[model samples]
Target: MKKENNTNKKAVCIMSGGMDSTLSAYMMKNQGYEVIAVHFNYDQRTQAKELACFENICESLHVKQKYILDLDFFKQLGASALTDTNIEVPTGGVEEGVPVTYVPFRNGIFLSMAAAIAEKEGAEVISIGVVEEDSSGYPDCREEYIQAMQKAINLGTKDDTKIEIKMPLVHLKKSQIVQEALHLDVPLELTWSCYKNEDKACGVCDSCRLRLNGFKKAGVNDPIPYA
Candidate 1:
């Protein structure tokens, strides 16, 4: 991890109230960086609940700042289960074609917004918590996609100075990410990864299933309640 200059350096982390993203923010903060967390509100079925969790986590960690951007525009485009409540979030990761839960170009849009915010905030880096292991078939989460986005940011941003896209968990498996979060003393209980908005995690959606498996592989009992 490249250390930013301690004086007047700012970073904006794309936080989604999930284990990987929460851990990414914690790690950045630990490195003495001024961290700002950004969450997108896409009017998904679980948006409100996830925002609550995102706010709680950021407050608990005392992040320098947090931004919640409304993404209703993307919802209007509607091709994903996340944005379209009519479609069900897929269970397990064995389905054909990209999972129904794969939001259409979500990371691309989110990163573009984050880059603009970074320029305004005078941030040198924009960190996102995307892990290849968990992504499996998600094109947006791949290293190639991230690299392309970085190139675009450099070309498009006003600062002439390149904005680095940091992906600490890029190569690590979800289990490894969980272990790292635990080591960093991140509050896993504050994060939310369920596709359902019920009292407990549905435990079958792609996100929920992956999270549970990661905890099991890491030999750590997940702190969150599940259905």
Candidate 2:
């Protein structure tokens, strides 16, 4: 996302209340953009926790405008473990190829909704925290795929409405993400990344493992609790 000297520019940030997205929102704020926060409740396993975290993070960011959209359809069309109870969230580790945790075109759906919101709000950009280099193998997180989505979004929207989809963490490793978040003073404790167990993060889940590994690599202790 481009830094602006004026605060008139707006960004609709797709925040999942995770470390990466929280950091992205802060980066936008630091760049002098008025942020409009958006969170999706897709009936994922950790929906409640994520929502709570989103609210807290938004408060801390002093975000006045926000949207908490409920997307229950993701539960109905569940193939991924995050939205489907039938499928178990893998505790082993991140796997090669697309994992079961990769909701079919999840980011695409999110970006589509965000685009509509951005056009409605007259925002110039939409920010998301999709890490491709060091992340669970989700096809939609790829930078190439996101660039394609940006093109598709621009083509689909009104002629005058031009919105850029920005993924700041797309190429960053988890360790780098942690370092950046720390530098930005993002409230890491307010973020949740576990795919299972909302109360105490299941430390063995792919999300938890990745988060822990990031903190380890950064030589910082993770503030969130794990079980």
Candidate 3:
């Protein structure tokens, strides 16, 4: 009875305005999908900076359709260092267990939101930059978890809604991710990966450490500033 507005093959990409996420969005475009960039402001420490990066990245990607959703619940429920100022983001090195920076079920929540957009936009795919190997051991970044979410999303949406969650960097090491981003000509400088500090990246935070290490291993210079 209802006519659905359909266009070319489309994809909904959840970008954090970070290097990995930026690369994933680019990869989706390379795959010949009409990319709809979706970014969230969950009131993380670097929320403002990340939002800025997301805008710049979308411009570079030449994506006209974009969504920026502000979710203040993360600040209200802040056990993670990213959302709570009381908790310190780890800086020494990648810890053995899940770091304090792991926002509770962050990717799951993000994927759920992305799915809604995908189904509405008549998108066939959802892409996220969730790195598992050589990451800070975030449970939601695992391939199994993403696969499970994909199944759940398909089941929950309309019977004809077939959305596949694509984790381009899920299995790649940080170095490998860096290499792929470079190869894809993604605007890496427009991305930010710092977990602490806003102006200049702390360089020692878990996110910065991984990003720097990746560039080093890939023999590429990170264009972003560090303090």
Clashes of each: 0, 0, 0
lDDT of candidate 3 over 178-208, digit per residue (tens): 8888888888989999999789999999899
lDDT of each: 0.85, 0.93, 0.91
Q: Identify the runs in model 2 with alpha carbons over 4 angstroms from their true place.
A: 1-4
Q: Which candidate, 1 or 3, would have the higher TM-score against the true structure?
A: 3
Candidate 2's residue-wise lDDT over 1-227, tens digit each? Answer: 34558659999999998999999999999889899999999999999999999999999989989999998899999999999999998888778778899888889999999999999999999999999988988889899999999999999999999999888999999999999988888889999999989999999988899999999999999999988
RMSD of 2: 1.8
lDDT of 1 by residue, 1-227 (tens): 44445766778999988888999988887776788889999877688778888999989778767898997886898888888888877775657767777788889999999998998888888999998766646779898899999999999877566699999999998789888988888999999888876468888887887888899999989998987
The full ranking of all candidates by TM-score, starting with the best, is 2, 3, 1
Cα lDDT over the full model 1: 0.85
Q: What is the lDDT of residue 50 in candidate 3?
A: 96
What TM-score would every model get versus the actual structure? 0.94, 0.97, 0.96
lDDT of 2 at 187: 88
